[model samples]
Target chain A: MFTAPLVVAYPYKRTVGTLLSRFFQSLQEGRLEGTKGSDGRVYFPPAEFDPVTGRQLDEWVTLAETGTVVTWAWQSAPQPDQPLERPFAWALITLDGADVPLLHAVDAGDMARIRTGSRVKVRWADERSGGIRDIACFDLLEGAS
Target chain B: MARRDVAIVATAQRPNEVGSTLTSVELILPVINDVIAKVGIERQKIGFWCHGSCDYMSGQPFSFVAAVDAIGAWPPIVESHVEGDGALALYEAWVKIQTGECDVALVFSNGKTTSGPIDRILNLQADPYMVTPLWPGFDSLAALQARACLDAGVLSEADMAEVAARSYRDALNNPIAYAKENVTAEQLLARPYTTAPLRAHDCGVPVDGANAIILAAGDAARSLAERPAWIRGIDHRIDTQRLGARSMTESSSAAIAAAKAGVGDDRIDIAELHAPYTHQEILLRRAMNLGEGTHVNPSGGALVSNPAMAAGLARFAEAAESVFSGSADRVLAHCTSGPMLQQNLVCVMEGE
Candidate 1:
């Protein structure tokens, strides 16, 4: 069998659109923002249009850095380019004040530490960029109520 | 209501295999030839040609364009392509016939899912900014869904194991299935988890394969086959792209599609669901309200031989084969796209 190095890359950049552009920009500033849908449900990773109504949404709501894990799966082996180099839990976290949850990695240190309904807080990356990676991952909160 | 009745006249598929060295054209040509020969239709007589495939899976831009060589477009013929699964291409052909633009159409799809890191490659299908950046593979995402189902009390681990066990048992009769063995649910539960709450058996057996299906209008269909699987109703629906925003335990789009496709209108003898994960099959069973009487995944379904772009259409072919063989009068076939069953297509077929 023949083998060679092949790289699939997109060198060019594209705009993130109105709502998402703002969401990422806010992330870089070490804050969280969500867009309120017509149904009054706040969606994290703010969508440009209300998912149900299909209408444009501009109402922005500032969200807390802490959230509760709705559900999660333990990732025993981390894949390349993942949020964490070590083992972590892939979780759907509902940020405080937001009706909907967002998917991200949770650095629970061990499987026993993370569970459904466990509280987690964002752990900001030292280096800031206008992207989801700006927050390295979520961390388990100590003595979480 | 359909403007004109459309039926699947002929279908052919390459046996699912892992890491086949054949090129796209090589994989597609045989099936294309086989289906056409089965229908005994002249190549030029086919009013339209539709193809379904993915450039990402092929690792080349315009890869589907190269597959047209199998059809030999010398005189130039009416054709189309979908960047998704072959079942969607069949839907397009069905619509083409309904539009009075064509009486007969050819639909085909091929993919070598095992050529690359399938789990990592599938991560691209997720939301680019939010989920893709994290590089969460398909298995992990599916495991998350499985976990949610477990937490919600929708299904237990024993139930998931039973689905995998049944698929393995059913696949033994299917010559084309990649994975087949007479295993039990208890035995499956003994294996270690590949992704927690989801054993290796829970995931689809990815393979390199192709499938072709022929569609013809009322009279054309009657003449082509002794018994044609008439399309009673077909509908596709999509849920929100935001994965976490939707309920992971249930497939709302699947329910919507099943309703729109009139799945509950009559008793279904069989159901071929394209659920790659064992949990998803359980979820789809609930979504479509498939009763105990319905024989599910008799052809082993996606869990046995999942050829990415072709698996969905394979469900259609399998369901139709049941009708063609006089085994069932009415059947339901379901296909899913996007992560966690975000988009779903349901088709109900009956023999006349």
Candidate 2:
């Protein structure tokens, strides 16, 4: 097969907003929380305003980091500036405090064994100052006492 | 007046440069005036003003607000902006004319790809949590789709090269085109691949430029010209952004829009298609039900020059301009966004 040129796009700095700024800041302080919205959806990232009801959320609570991996896709070739240097799986992890799962990378070694309903724990990066990559990738909690 | 007979009266665009070292609202300011001057219409006569641009593209919010100053939008004109493509903005203005609310409207799109690596900026549109953090960038993600297309046998490397040859050949007639006097498709294939199954020819030249299209309705449209090209129909549709879940080869959104816009009955004399990539043009042509009788992308299509949000509207403008000049009686136009036309819009125009 012949080869051809391709064009691609990457990420640039985007604004997270005041409310999300606080939420992300708190997460960096070794804290975890979910904010309840009037629309009845508990958002882990903390919604500045309810998308459904158009109401603001001021309340929050600390939640457990343990969650089950609902589904995942293995990123065998990590792109530049990604959190992990090696192969990882992008997973929708349902943290204990939130009803819905949050998407994050998992340290799942291989795609074949990263099955549904895998229990995982947040492996916080040594440097955390609030951002999605703060968790880096979740580690398998299988043998942890 | 009923105001349903809105037509694109004038169109103007500047050359698309990779980084656009040019500055301010003035970058493409000269071209805007040139287009308006060709129509012999003053800018103040335009009743409605609208623009489509993305904040993420500029890496800042309300990036279009500054471009508005170029329009000299003072004393506060009725205006709006979309965070998406400029063609959608033109569609919004076109819809306003059809509704009898506004008689004339102006639309444009602008971006500076040189300010940052544009691929990184485009990732903001992806599934933020999972796909975005992985940072595949825009090309690799599209390459994944291109690879899928190859596996499905829906397209071949040479076919893309052929598309490039045909487009560049057509673009030779267009002075504003970016890909000018390029070599054969086989030679394009010989060039190294940027992503597997895709090449530089497969992608639109990254350009930073601004363009404006003006519209007129009913009597206002009539006064604007002796033979006005009227917008007969317009519609758009979007598919969910799950690349893994959706059909990889077909553009369902464009199909839905083509049906909604009543494309089946009209005789497409000339058609302009916005296919940022070569294979997508094939998908969109099938989706729009375009036939051999119809001239597809005589303006060299997006393969020649794409002003991001502006490319789609340029497709519409090109279709209308062809008819306006008495080259064709009826025409079809298609605009696309996302990988493989994840979102699509169709507009049919006819000359009186």
Candidate 3:
């Protein structure tokens, strides 16, 4: 067998745009922000326009760090570059006030602890950057089981 | 203006396999030659050529440009390409015929999924800022969808295992299929989960392959094949890109596309659905309203051999072949892209 290093890279930069700019900016401050749609639904990861109406949304809502797991799949063995190096649950979490859920990894210590509707809270990263990784991952809330 | 009738006259596909050392041109040339030979058509006489493939799949930019060599574009033939599955390219060819610009078109697609980490490569399709940065692989995302379907009571682990069991049993008849066996749901459930709630059999086996199809309009179609699979209706629709925002248990886009494609207007004798996961096959059956009478995935579908970029178009070829063989009068062929059946294309065909 022959072997060689094959690296696929996109070296260019991209603008995060209006809604995401604010969302990421908030992440740097250890806070979460969402966009309020014309239908009064708050969307986490803030969409620039309402999904149903296609209307521009600029209203921002401060979101809680805690949320409930809408759905989850246990990753028995995490792959390279994934959020967690060890076994974890990849979950869709609906923040306390948001109608839509955001996908992220949950460090629940073991598969037995994670389940649908389980409460979780963000575990902030030590170094804050204007990115989703600012909140490293969600952790199971104490005494929620 | 009344649209002209178009039909798939000829089709060819390479066997789905892993670690194919052949180049894209090497892999595509034989299929292209075979399809054109079946239709008895000259290379220069072909009105238009369209191709579907992703550069990221081969880890080479403008990878599809190399495939033009397979068709010998030196005579300056009309050509185009899509950075997706070949079914979308077939769609463009169908539209071209409707526009009265081209009477005959050739559509082809190929991919080497075994070249790299396919699961990680597919993650690039997710949202760059929010999702891709997390590097959530396709299998994990599919597992989440399966979990949601389980929670909603739309499907159970037993149901998914049954889909796998049936597909494996059916694939025994398919020469090109990679996975073929006579297994039971109980046997599959006894196995361990690769990703929670999803066994290895629940997912499609990734392979490297290519497929080509020849589409002709009106008189050209009638003269080419004894019984052509005429396109009755074709439509494509997509749901939200946000995986968390959409309903995981149902495929709204598939339902919409099926209705627009006139799937419910007639009794579908066969359905070749491109569902990569076992639960997804069940979900799509519900979305398209395909009943128990409809023969689903007779060629074993993607659950047996799923080659990225080419698998979707293979469904079209498989369904049309059923018509050509006089096994079915009306058939429904479906293709999907993105995560959790987020985007769907439904093409209804009939032998007339």
Instruction: List lDDT for all candidates, in order.
Output: 0.91, 0.73, 0.92
Cα lDDT tens digits, model 1, B201-278, are 999989999999999998999999999999999999999998977889899999999999999999999999999999
Which of the CAPRI classes, incorrect, acceptable, medium or high, describes model 1? medium
Model 1 chain A: weakest 10-residue lDDT segment is: A2-11
Q: What is the lDDT of residue A139 in candidate 3?
A: 91
Clashing pairs in 1: none
**Positional deviation of residue B83's Cα in model 1 after best superposition, in angstroms:** 0.5
Off by over 4 Å in 3: A1-3
Output the worst ten-in-a-row residue range by lDDT, candidate 2 chain A.
Answer: A1-10
Task: List the candidate numbers ranked by TM-score, top first.
Answer: 3, 1, 2
Q: How would the docking of model 3 be graded?
A: high
Give the candidate number with the greatest DockQ.
3
Give candidate 3's TM-score: 0.99
Model 2 alpha-carbon miss at residue A145, Å: 35
What is the Å distance of residue A32 in model 1 from its true position?
A: 0.9
Q: Which candidate comes out best when scored by lDDT? A: 3
Residues forming the 10-long window of minimal summed lDDT in candidate 3 chain B: B67-76
Q: Sort every candidate by DockQ, greatest first.
A: 3, 1, 2
Instruction: Give a tens-digit lDDT track for model 3, residues A54-136.
Output: 89999989999999998999889988888889999999999999999999999987889888999999999899879998989
